[model samples]
Target: MTPADPARRRLLLAGACLAAWPLAASAARAPQRVRDSRALMGTRLDVAAQGPDAEALQRAIDAAFARMTALSALMSHYAPASQVSAIGLAAGLQPVEVAPELMQVLHMARDVARRTDGAFDPTVGALGLWHFDAPQSSIPTASEIRRRISSVDWRHLVLDERRQTAYLTERGMRLDLGGIAKLSILQSGLDTLQAHGVGTALVNGGGDVVACSQRGDAPWRVGIRDPRAPQRLLATLEVRSGFVASSGDYERFFVQDGRRWHHVLDPRTGRPTEGVRGITLVADSLEAVNGLGTAGMVLGARAGRELLRRGEGVEALIASADGGLWMTDRLRARLVPVAG
Candidate 1:
């Protein structure tokens, strides 16, 4: 009467342990990370996140990409319904009301143009007559370029901040925010990740990347690609809560008769700048470094270095056409050069 049967006790103990197994597993499961990329706005927007629940992580990543897509629709010049297109259509006719976000971006573009003395003008969209994506890319004729150059002045892009309206004072005047819009979209993706409560994450909009928090104990590593050799890496950077953006002549160009014609144009001449082959900028805030990458190439190595120094926490690395290299001392410390 006092002793229990051994086989029965063993069976009961096994059942109790089985019931507790699921609870133990739930408590012990560590957060898993997910990484994904979506092609949007002619470039890939990449997202990576870590969360205790896999489904939550996936949802956060999707939300981040959705944010990027929505911003692209608002700012893209290709989208017929985009605010940028609306502004272009109203050129010389009247002021077009735009969303506050578009107004902010337009203001930033104008600021960059003034800072670089029109080197990074958004009104260079007047030269949008040249198409690199055509069936056969070709350079514009001198006469055609001259005709359009008359409308390429940034001063013509009048932004009324109080009204949140933009006006292109010339009939053929156009606006393109290809420079800073992408970076701003990347930042928006990061904000989405944070809104979803995803702490450790990375949002890489093609060449521009913003990393938040740390991956485990180490910071995220980003590769700076060689402008001449897209397949090779020029340097690697380790960062936590930092933004890295690059601009390169190789990004969009066609070679003709041993001459390279790229898309990053100089507003004054209606031609691409030939000073630097590529420029990469690292900064604490994405907005702070927005448009500076291309501005660096147009600003040249000397002015480029000076432009970066003016910022609170900004550094740059520039590769010149003459096979020369220039980098800020702070960036040099954080950069690990790739070996030949």
Candidate 2:
């Protein structure tokens, strides 16, 4: 149940937390784009839209934020009152009935864990020994890690479709939806926008963005960070629809003895993963790229690339631990490399 969004390592510039972008110009007859931001799940959530009705678009944005807020309350691992916490609290006891949305995300997490061979597990809730947050950032001892790692299995989490419940078979097991819930919530935000008939809009949270463009409008532009150069952007990605999700060591991390420890843990080892500095994925749907970004981080470069290559339209941008950059063939076409 770690707090999300460190305001670091994200490709897009978020509110008051990322590198600054230049002011934009508006043409005399240009249509107005309404943009608003709110801090949700510890990250800056932004919504930008351009349409005929500015007031209606604003209302749509409000509804989107409201949907995200409600979903996070149900699924946030950090929230003690959340259904996720309740399921963990009932581990080894009995199944806990959960909301439909929580059930859907749980199913999604299980699917990702299955596909990634446990690399993208949501059941790493017990591996919370490392505190990356300041004032108490401490790494766990080997013994502690071993003890916690024993309970970090995604297989033990069972969901009952008929009963609408979630159960962890093992005692002391925990659930941390920090990985996938954000995207689902944000997807819900986009759904809210569409429900309100706002077609062209972008929803950005943390470093992840989901957006669409009108037929006559220019595509939404997002800046992607260069892991090798923290202060610099590697490239800009234009989006018409779909999503851009990223995972990096810089997100929630600390250094000890020159070694960096991050929140993205290897479920098997119950420690921070290695051999990849960051991973960014762009695809047509959340289902296409849900846990793959972090999975690539855990899988490293070659295997990560192979994994991504398997998917039809999943474009990847991987910054390896050695500082080398690798990307999918198709992704190169979507990028405009940033000039120094």
Candidate 3:
């Protein structure tokens, strides 16, 4: 299929959501497969096996979805009643005991923040003042941005590994997992499927996709959407086992006064990233892809590539704000450019 084909994009989305679920009318089908109910994470999850394994596949999919829902409830900062929100409310006053999953994600968040030199900070919760998704959007004043920037310090997050307690060193500090949590959950789902005797699986959460297992007759193909032309494809990657995560300025943004304000906040400035239209990362692990995607968006183009290069098992493709495209040697080798 052509990468830019609308049907291809839709199919990709369907495959990502349903993972192993067989398409209703597709000519291909495995011996045993069943589609499961959608999960609270808003992604479709299904399983397909080659033998008389319907019951086993169903159980595996159900267990994976349940774990994902529980993790979402615990780590969601938007849900004021979640553990993350509770910790934000109690910031600086007392330590809050977090779930093991939450602690693990937080630790990874902190490490990425340090590696990116605070570019991919979890403390971007301070920028809660702006909502680009709103109908009427306004840019925060310089003074307001400065005030919020002061609260964006990843070091303030103190974790007691033994007790699984996390304390925010300052009041008003919060953790926004919108950056990586969903992809992390997808990775975990893939791992679960692998353990269930499912030799191959694909997990696609919106723009992020993770695929594993021996290749079929043809290598698995992933399309890279064009930010300037959503209906068109920019490139495709032939991947067998790894993760692909993308962050795009086009997905969530508001145009005001001839400028676009997107959801990707620069912790140092408390403003949307500029000069970067989108970033996509290919990595062996979800942690690397998710972390680097965020860092790449914040670092823009040049520095973002450097950041990805420093991390092992990671490669990146960057789309500049001006519509120029660049990829590291590692990524270029796997990329199949699509005609505009």
Candidate 4:
């Protein structure tokens, strides 16, 4: 055939476009990696995963978030109808049966309380009457604090493992798992992702996070946000696996008389813990250092160092209000400070 005409050339191009349409659509729909986030347990929970297809990744994300929702229902103090609230209502009166997961978290809370010498008491719930976010400014009276402090004893938390029951020996006592429960829930979400055959995933429960596998060939990188400047990062880490928990005094608090009255309460004083501004701990599991950060804020640098030394693979970076940083050598090695 001699040289084709312009009309013949246009018809040939149209045929080629129609033939490639299906393949272009297929490539567009192919899934590589995805991230999902939702607010649950009174905090933002996030999941990142890589999958062969979008549907599989969505299913895994749903499962992970569902696990968090269930745990929150069982443990959240904000939920008046929750099992935790029920236990509070029945305090000192009867032993309330609870789910195995709740029992496990409570046990872990007790362990932290003992290890911290009551510095990590979940019984600080007795001090919940104080509201930092109230429209009208108010502080708890010393007499009222003293009376509430009487019921703020972790020793009074009686658990019957045989019956899977929890009891508070004081009528007005309450349990607040605000410190440790988040980490436990994060671990549970990671476990759910694993069960769903997702090998590469990260479950971030607010400031606490856990990674299952590398981000592609490289390790997952996470930023530790600056406590003083919420928008800036103090440091970043290249984490291959395991947990990172960051606790800060600025997380929930109100300014009063030029002082930050935060939510990290000390059961002993029935008031917010002072001294340390923030603490970030890296460990193999939440079981290793779940509530240590909160207790570290109360104990200050000297005792915080001693407490961290007791753990085998735990590393920490603690910041004080004096603009000084106290960090374990191991954490220093892995942490990259953000350059100003």
Candidate number of the best TM-score = 2
Error of 3 at 120 (Å): 1.0
**lDDT (tens digit, per residue) of candidate 2 on 65-150:** 99999999999778899999999899999999999999999999999999989989988998877799887899999999999889
Worst 10 residues of 4 by lDDT: 12-21
- RMSD per candidate (Å) reads 11.7, 6.3, 4.5, 11.0
Q: Pairing residues by index, what is the TM-score of model 1?
A: 0.87
Clashing pairs in 4: none
lDDT for 66 in candidate 2 is 91
- Candidate 4 lDDT over 1-340, as tens digits, reads 1234231122101100100000111334343566787878655666777557768878988998898899888999778988888888999899899999999999999989998999999888888777866574468999999989999999999899999999998899998999988888888888998888777777776578787663343356677876656556677776767888888876667898898788888888988887788888888877887999889988887788789888778998888777778888888888777689
Q: Candidate 2: TM-score?
A: 0.91
Per-residue CA lDDT of model 3 for 200-272, tens digit only, reads: 5566665777776543423347777766565567777776678878788876678887878888888877888
Q: Name model 1 segments beyond 4 Å from true.
A: 1-29, 214-217
- Please give, for residues 24-135, the per-residue lDDT of candidate 1 as tens digits: 1232445475768678867666676766777998998888888788889999998999989999999999999998878888988989888777778888778887776546
Provide the global lDDT of candidate 3 against the true structure: 0.72
- TM-score: which is higher, 2 or 4? 2
Model 3 CA lDDT for position 297: 81
Give the least accurate 10-residue stretch of model 3, judged by summed lDDT.
15-24
Model 4 residue 325 lDDT score: 81
